[model samples]
Target: MKHNVILVVLDGLNYQVARHALGHLQAYCDAGRAALYRLDCELPSLSRPLYECILTGVPPIASGVVHNDVVRLSNQRSIFHYARAAGLTTAAAAYHWVSELYNRAPFEAVRDRHTDDADLPIQYGHFYYADHYPDSHLLADAEHLRLRHKPNFLLVHPMNIDDAGHKHGLDSPQYRNSARRADIILADYLQAWLEAGYQVLVTADHGMNTDRSHNGLLPEEREVPLFVLGSAFSLDAAVRPRQTELCGTVCELLGVEHDKPVCRELLK
Candidate 1:
């Protein structure tokens, strides 16, 4: 059977927080239905650069998206780009920076907010500008796009955790609560997606620190959780994965050729 894939990036989710807080995702790991990996996200661990790293499999220094302020169209081929090149549909319900990276540069809220352009890497997009935009709403938008387009590759990014971390330190109740909320929300749709034969990967761009900021080499700021659910994965705990391998892994799941390196040991 042909497989579809969904990549969910829960921004600013720390590995220890996910191991402790995300009960729903943990249940899957406990039941042997999902594999959980501790990944150290690329350095200069900010959002946009990590987003670029996650999607393009290129590190910030090489990708030239070293900071969140450097907003422009990405030069590297993303999973969406490879999927589209293979005549597959792609969709994303994510931050505006995602739209800027894969769809257009300098995202104009008026022109790029809700896009449906066949020529773009993300053929269907629901991009939001506000960091405070509710995760519930973003998930709803992703569900809407899924039902409407049935895209071969889907990207679902939510910002609430990151926003909470920026406002409150990573150790605060607010940050933990945000991760819990996202886990609760995922429980609503994950079963249906799995039943529908979609390969799903839930991870983070980067982690947050107790200092209420990132862009450091600290484990709390660099390590994040990766939860995988699908037949393509082996759930082999021995095979550690890096953030850069996500793009290649997704490309392989979609049966597309890619130059990015993949974590082959993690796959059956």
Candidate 2:
């Protein structure tokens, strides 16, 4: 069987935010097809390091990304690398770090220029950044690629939640609204992808805290959601998987070797 996966990362989504604002997201928890867990990403919990950890299945310390100071990915293993080895097409539209790390991601990557960047032209990908790009342009771009390239592993990451949380702590209405908007966005894309025969994973790099900014010892900053909604996973068997176990899961789905002890087949 030709297995496919679509990973959607909602940055800086605290568990409380999801629980309170994302009523739509609760469907995944009730659906037997989904496995939901509250998993701690990594220390620092910054976007750069956490996302690196997520893609590489290694902590920031091991991945050589202790802070947001770095731009490119070094010689390391990532989901994209595994996908390529298995002859699967891959693509992503996310933050600049992603594009910078993989040189347009080795397949196709949009740096997701946000309007928040003050209209600075993206030097890498041709896609221009806009403030409303996440809810509008990003989704359109992802759908276009899905229909055109049919990549086996596609990642769509939206950062509005993070921005909102940073600007107006998680308790603020903006943060709550961002969470709801994120849920709607994910629901729309997930439904479309599932209808077109794709497994979907909704997870986050980090969470927000009482403080307007993230990155601290607080659990809110470290713990994030990890929800897998798919057809291959047995509804009868559910597992609380660690963040590092994702590499093995992807490798298993792609029919490749992933012998890391932290990696395991989480499905039944």
Candidate 3:
């Protein structure tokens, strides 16, 4: 693979909320440099299951990561797996569950918090356990990985939006403020990443609801925002991309061969 990618999952950010709060990203969309799409995440709209779904192009029922607590390594091949198989480097600054899925299961914070094992699917990782770990710090961790390791595929998962939603509900200022904050933090490094030749995908595993909890079929829980920034994307508003399609799209962006279906319409 000759190209690189960074997938940022703004944990629990809703489509409506993102559209209103992510002004910096909206600027890219306004300038026609990015495409914003609204997509329904796979059920049951939980983080862990959808993480596997987004990375493997497989639904929860098929992947068997049907809930957040199903702690085990993914049986389905992920973007990290495909990237690694292609002899490309992979890294992530994400929730510990991500590490539990790709690197090791039953996360041991002391041993698994910082991993740099070549044998692991995510070769370089900085995994965090707390929900309030701070998005700014996570993005900084991701930037550090990008500058140091130059991974072909990097996953940046931040939990602040979800954390705010859980604490103050979706309609509260805290949730909206969190989205706004994440956007500002992203604006800080987006240009640098683009100049460095990395295609970026900003999205979420699922959305937060008014109930301050998810795992149901409500629109707020299922609907999420996808912002694609790169020359590889077509930026066509008519093309609807699925969460499951992300894995294959990323594979295509990195020139990795995979069986999963790519979002052909979304690609140039």
- Cα RMSD, each candidate: 0.8, 5.4, 0.8
Ordered from best to worst lDDT, the candidate numbers read 1, 3, 2
Steric overlap count per candidate: 0, 3, 0
Q: Candidate 3's residue-wise lDDT over 1-268, tens digit each?
A: 3579999999999999998899999999999999899999999899999999998999999999999989999999999999999999999999999999989999999999999899999999999999999898999999999999999999999999999999998899999999999999999999999989899999999998888999999999999999999877899999989888999999999999899988989888
- The candidate, 2 or 3, that scores higher on TM-score is 3
Model 1 residue runs over 4 Å out of place are none
Candidate 2, which ten residues in sequence have the lowest lDDT sum? 115-124
lDDT of 1 by residue, 1-268 (tens): 4579999999999999999999999999999999999999998999999999999999999999999999789999999889989999999999999999988889998999898998989999899999999999999999999999999999999999999999998999999999999999999999999998999999999999999999999999999999999887899989899899999988988999789999988778
Per-candidate TM-scores read: 0.99, 0.85, 0.99
What would you estimate as the lDDT of candidate 2?
0.69
Q: How far is candidate 3 from the true structure (C-alpha RMSD, Å)?
A: 0.8
Off by over 4 Å in 3: none
